[model samples]
Target: MSELSPYEIAFLSGGPTRVAQTALLALYESDRIRVSRGTHRVEVLPREPEDLHPVQAAVIDQVPGTGRLLGAVLEAVAAAPEVRAVADALVSGGLLRAGLRGALRPTGEGKALRRGFETSPGEGDVLRLAALGPEGVQDAKMREILSTDDPKPVKMPKKPKGGHRDLDSSGLSDTQYSAGL
Candidate 1:
């Protein structure tokens, strides 16, 4: 990061309304760039600047999912009502350019937005399943393990052996048994 002046820092930190003033401060801070603030303003700084505009870089970095809504970008950066003011300042300063669907893109900004979804507790299950792949073999195994019960057989009470003696005796006679032999 380049060395920031107190005025520049104050201007940048003074909410989104002071974005134009912040840009001017940033331009003044840059050794390779000069700016003039007035009607028919003309000022020549140096060329081939080594550093880029910080505010524009930050705005670009906040943009996500390609061609994002202006309001959404503002909310993402927590800039709220000041977003339009800051955006207008950046546009006028030529530090930012509007892209498709009114999305802001930084000029000469490198690797603006960090691409990825935030990891939250709510997404744990989704991330786990995604990591496991679409086959769901791990899920099946987990379900099987969870559904298993104790491996024990049920026991029944024993009945008296003589309980059916009368019925058995009625079905046969002593003469029939002797003839069978």
Candidate 2:
């Protein structure tokens, strides 16, 4: 099999989430996208490259004008039709199989590609390390995204118990009702 692209390697190593995360890392590194620290919001910059992969483009499109949360962007991209197309293509090419727990199992060719990538990764493959599931990633930016960049949790107000006021507080009692018709 021919050498696989970083996207292919990322999918083989992990799954759609990894693909999305790797694509985001690439875009971030290339200045195609901007990730807000602390809040983890993502926004597509103007003058985006025209040669982006479908998955990368999808990620950009997924972000709204106001920007989206990092975790939301990752989830959106992972489930996007473009990313699914990549998985479908790989499966059609006999390089991947659907394994237990929705995991992607690589075929022989896929295995060889992964072996090659792990053995001698190409330049700028450091961003792809996040696709490998947080291990072997040394880049500060990549590690920051993987470790600290997540959507901030919404702070919901606590609900009152029993959902009603006390019956004793009412002026009337159950026994006080008239039974006469």
**Cα lDDT tens digits for candidate 2, 44-96:** 88883579888888988899889999888989889899888878878888899
For each of the candidates, give the backbone clash count: 0, 0
Instruction: State the lDDT of candidate 1 residue by residue for 1-181, as single tens digits.
Output: 2332222222233334233233322343453223222211213353563545455334345443333333333244435333455556655655456779976655442112101111211132222222221122134532232123323333433348735334343344567558855
TM-score, cand. 1: 0.22
lDDT of each: 0.35, 0.75
In candidate 1, what residue range of length 10 has the lowest lDDT sum? 113-122
Q: How many backbone clashes does candidate 2 have?
A: 0
lDDT agreement of model 1 with the native:
0.35
- Candidate 2 scores a C-alpha RMSD against the true structure in Å of 13.1
